[model samples]
Target chain A: MKKEWPLWEVFIRSQHGLAHKHVGSLHASDAEMAINHARDVYTRRNEGVSIWVVRSADVVASSPDEKAPLFEPANSKVYRHPTFFPMPEEIKHI
Target chain B: MSNDTVQYLLRLGDNALILSHRLSEWCGKGPALEEDMALANTALDLLGQARLWLSYAGELEDAGRDEDALAYRRNDRQFCNLLLVERPNGSYADTMVRQFFFDAWHHLALQGLCRSADERIAGIAAKAIKEVEYHLRRSSDLVVRLGDGTAQSQKMMQRAVDELWTYTGEMFESDGVDEQAVVAGIGFDPVALREPWLSYVREVLSEATLRIPPADAFMQKGGKQGRHTEALSYLLGEMQYLQRAYPGAQW
Candidate 1:
């Protein structure tokens, strides 16, 4: 009888200071194997320099039911848009 | 280019072409989905490198053959890849061992070719070096993983090492073709790559908890001279079948 390894979620950081974005998942016997598999599966096209693999079971997620009532208030906030700000003539670098 | 120089370049192309076709044999058959993708992706890289090499060889030949013509039209005796690349892919262990050995040599050879006095070979080598580096890394990682993994895996790996050790010798063998290319500044002497290749491979084997094959192991040769085991003919039969049947058919 064949047994399968656990699944892992792969996150890739393309460069420094950037968040590791979720790429996809794969199976491996351990953390090291997971990272190796992730490198081969995700980074083949110059995709990333850094990888983060976490057991899919360890990840926490909000329920899709929380989509509206728990977060809908921000949708009405027009002030969140950067267009409302006028550029100051002296604030060149910003 | 001298005919020997052209022959040297064609050998490099043939190595990639034959190895790519061998790797594609694992399609839909890898132990895991991720591995399937990895092997296929590797095959794709080899095929792309082969196109560049054979196309350049065709230009050097100046005999009106294009990449397709050179790849599809060539018969077995004309091929000059190392015996290691054209050997059959046995088990998964066999495939990985073959891959690791070839990738190690490929990476080292490309590192030298990047500095070739001939800019065109240097350019192609430099471009392909990155892909080869990743290939080496992936195969080395697997070699370590399986070598250090379960007892059954170690046994399989040990067997693979023993089976493929004989084929490793041919990669370092050079002849008049290589001599001409080296003098013409279009190729590197693969013999010089031997020490570094041994060091790197031994280090990987050490970490993998695998034993190196005994030095007295029987070594096979002659692929560089266009002689191969019967396996290459079978491989080329499948690879060249469509091209031979259709001749000029294209979608």
Candidate 2:
């Protein structure tokens, strides 16, 4: 059997005041190397300020193909959003 | 023609060019695919920096040559890079140690270059220093983590450091270009750069739980005048192949 590191999924915040979004995955010997690998791979363009790499197996992601039932149902609940309560035109704070 | 300025620029350009060649060798052979891409990217940055510096040097000399002409056409005897950069990438440990050493030196050099009187050189320095600063930080972080982390890593890091430490001296010692640039306020005396560099390196090494190689031994020298090691020839053959073959051909 070939010896190799487990895969890791990397997420990064491109800048301050931004959300951490999935970037890419890399293989590394351990957590530290995973983070280093992510920095080198995903952040070279100065595209990110923060990086988070987790073991690929540790991530629990919802299947993208099931999005209609998993997410569209929530979107159809009009009561879940506050758009119906819109009133004052002068209310600057949305 | 200011011989000192020409020499100074060649030193800077040669350092970047040779190191870029070395780094490019990691394109397919890095420990991981991510590292491979990262190294290749960094190599591009270095090669770009070299082109700018070499072109600038050519202009200052009023020479009809361009960057490619200087980079590919120059004989080994005309190159002036330090020996540390020309050594082969022996292992992951070896490459990292070589990078760590050069990054530290480059940070100091760039810091000085940013203040150069030549506006163009200063601008190039300003642009490149930011990237190089990050390179230094990342390399230093890896050194700390690996040196202090596992027995295998620690042993390899230590061995690499010990083997590479001998070449660290020539980096700070001035030849002729050093003096000229210093006088022109476009240069730094590498001797003056040594103390701060040592302190910075010591702090990082200490935090990494790595001991400084003893100062008792004599230092290796001769890269400034192009007395490169055996590895440089092979590296040059690969790097200069296309340019040397096509003499003046360009896209």
Report lDDT per candidate. Answer: 0.91, 0.86
Predicted structure 1: clash tally: 0
**Model 1 steric clash pairs:** none
Classify candidate 2 by CAPRI docking class.
medium
Q: Kindly report which residue pairs in candidate 2 clash with one another.
A: none
Among all windows of ten consecutive residues in candidate 1 chain A, which has the lowest summed lDDT? A85-94
DockQ of 2: 0.57
What does the lDDT come to for candidate 1? 0.91
lDDT of 2 by residue, B81-170 (tens): 999999888888788888889999999999998999988989999999988987788789778877897798898989998999998999
- Kindly give the stretch of ten consecutive residues in candidate 1 chain B with the minimal lDDT sum: B1-10
DockQ of 1: 0.62
Clashes of each: 0, 0
TM-score of chain A of each: 0.78, 0.72
- What lDDT does candidate 1 reach at residue B244? 98
Candidate 1, residues B1-251, lDDT tens digits: the string is 46877788889899999999999999999999989988999999999999999999899899999999988988998898999999899999999999999999999999888989888899999999999998999899999989998999999999999889999988887788887777877788888988899999999999999999865568999999989888999999999999999998898
